[model samples]
Target: MILAATGMRREARIIARAGLVPVISGGDAGRLRGLLTAQAARASAIVSIGIAGALSPELRVGDIVVGDRVLIPPRNGEGDHPQGGGGERATFGGFAGPSTACGGPPPRDKLGEELLTVLPGARRGVACGSDAMVITAAAKARLYEACGGTLPLIIDMESHVAAQVAQEHGLPFAFIRVISDRADQDLPPAVTCGLKADGSMAILPVLAALLRKPAQLPALIRTARDTDRAMRSLLAACDVLARGGVGLADRG
Candidate 1:
């Protein structure tokens, strides 16, 4: 089984469609820990895909990445891990959670790359996973300060929990994320207005918000279109990795 809870919902959707059993997760680190404790034997590897913020000067909307040196707050003074290059990073405000450096350079960090071999034209970079969703310009500015201007390009919730789980289970974890809205993009509040505590759709809030923002249609449509295209690319990659029967050797 391959997991996508480290971040992206799109990853689970695509992986599930490709017949790779997916176990969903979120920012709740404890839940992921419990899942790993219960199901490590059957899991050959793990993958976390979702949205992330860019840290370096190189990254843009619709670009895909899959690296692993995640640093969050709540730390105990540990150095950074040189994981893979091709994952998205986080860029946002204050300390949302404890920072844990989950992935380091393995003797053979081939899973993310091998998986991407099927992604064809998808661009690759370093992904900085964090515990917060970056949605505003002010927040981005603060994130720039927090990460010492090595701020992540994209931002979303939930990735470290997955990484922590993988650590405890001794599972090889691969992470992937796409750029939804960059730090410079001022997304309409509607993107999160109707989001409930459970991340479910709220009819009243959505309807009310939609009625209030008639001018947001174009931006919303653009966002939808971009996300759809990105998701399709992720699905295409999943199809190749799963259906192609690509078996990769584990490097010690």
Candidate 2:
């Protein structure tokens, strides 16, 4: 069976469209690891599917990034502490740890290449799995320098964890991330506050934030529009995967 790890409810819905049961890990690496550890026994492969921030300037909102490799920083000796009570509980938003040069899982080559066949126009590259948001253009450039110009196509929170967990279980792994923001775009400060401890968006925090800075409305609307485009792209990718049987263990 294919197990999909998604960061949001909308992403879960998209992965479900591809005939896999999606586990919502709430954008927390530890929680993602725990969820996969428990359910990976029956899984033949693990897939990380969701929206991601662009790390490469060439990427735009709605671009599909199919990762050949996942790059994540080593955990700071925390040793299996679950993030925010578990994937099920209310959780704080985003990752706060520093990134380092660490090797992560590679997608099964045949399956990985086949994604390009079924889903034309998808970009294939290394995806950086970060514990914290790389929010600004300057940060993305700095990250590129930090990686010695490794040119990560996108940045996300949970893909590395899924890849790492799948490696421990000897399962094949893949990542499909839709770009929700551009490389140079700075996420609104309130975006983080709007996310609850469980990784879901809460209205109260958003309202409070708007009350404090009403001028952020235009940026917020732009983000929402970009997200809508990304979601639609993700849905299209899911349909392609479903039709091609990309992750089916029984496929020859």
Candidate 3:
């Protein structure tokens, strides 16, 4: 079976298939790690598929990014490490100090390259995992500058955990992310506090936040619109994967 890890329940629902088990993290890194650990034994390969915030200026909402490698923040000791802010710069072990690469080299012969093959317009780049949401355009810019390179960068909550688990279990891993927010966009406060523990939208909290600050409605609407576009792109990508038999070929 293929293990598909995602941050939100909606994404999990999108990637669900006959041979794939979708795990939702609900935006919690510890929960994600634990879920992947429990599910890794029965899986052949792992793929992190969902909507992600873009850190590259050139990327737009609805664009697909295939992760060549995942840049995860360095852990201080063990257990679950704290999520870093977009402005808080750190390198990965091989590249710099704030983030570290998980699961060796890119999976060219595996799922990563195959995704690009199927989605002809998709771009291959680095995927950065953050425990916290990278909400601001400035934060995204700082992260992009700190983790300087030519390759495009995208940030999300689940890819690192998926990559780590795949490495531990000797399973091939792939990352397929659709850009939900661009580098120039700042996610509204209401949108950030909108998800429930189950990864579903928390309507009450969103409403409360908006009541407290009505000015956020415009930004929230834009975010919602962008998210819709991203979801459509993700659905299309999943359809392509299903028709191409991308993750179903090797059962391992």
**TM-score per candidate:** 0.69, 0.82, 0.86
Sorting all predicted structures by lDDT, with the top scorer first, yields 3, 2, 1
Error of 2 at 118 (Å): 1.4
Model 1 CA deviation exceeding 4 Å by range? 6-11, 26-37, 53-57, 73-109, 122-124, 148-153, 193-204, 212-217, 245-252
Strongest candidate by TM-score: 3
Candidate 3 off by > 4 Å:
17-19, 73-109
Show the lowest summed lDDT stretch of 10 residues, model 2. 86-95
lDDT of 3 by residue, 1-252 (tens): 888888887887778743468888888889988988997898888888999998889999999998547775433222123254344433331232323333344232456767788885899888877887878887777667655645888988888778777876777787889999999998887777778878888899999999999999999999999999999898888878767455465664
Best-fitting candidate, scored by lDDT = 3
Model 1, 1-252: lDDT tens digits are: 655563334455676765555555444445555665577667766566655545444566667765553444321111112122223332111223333333433333466566556566555443444434445555554544444444343444555555556665666666667666665665666665544443344558756777897887787787667667667666666666655544632321
* Every candidate's lDDT: 0.53, 0.68, 0.76
Candidate 1 differs from the real structure by a C-alpha RMSD in angstroms, to one decimal, of 7.4
* lDDT string, candidate 2, 61-84, tens digits: 998988646654322223211122
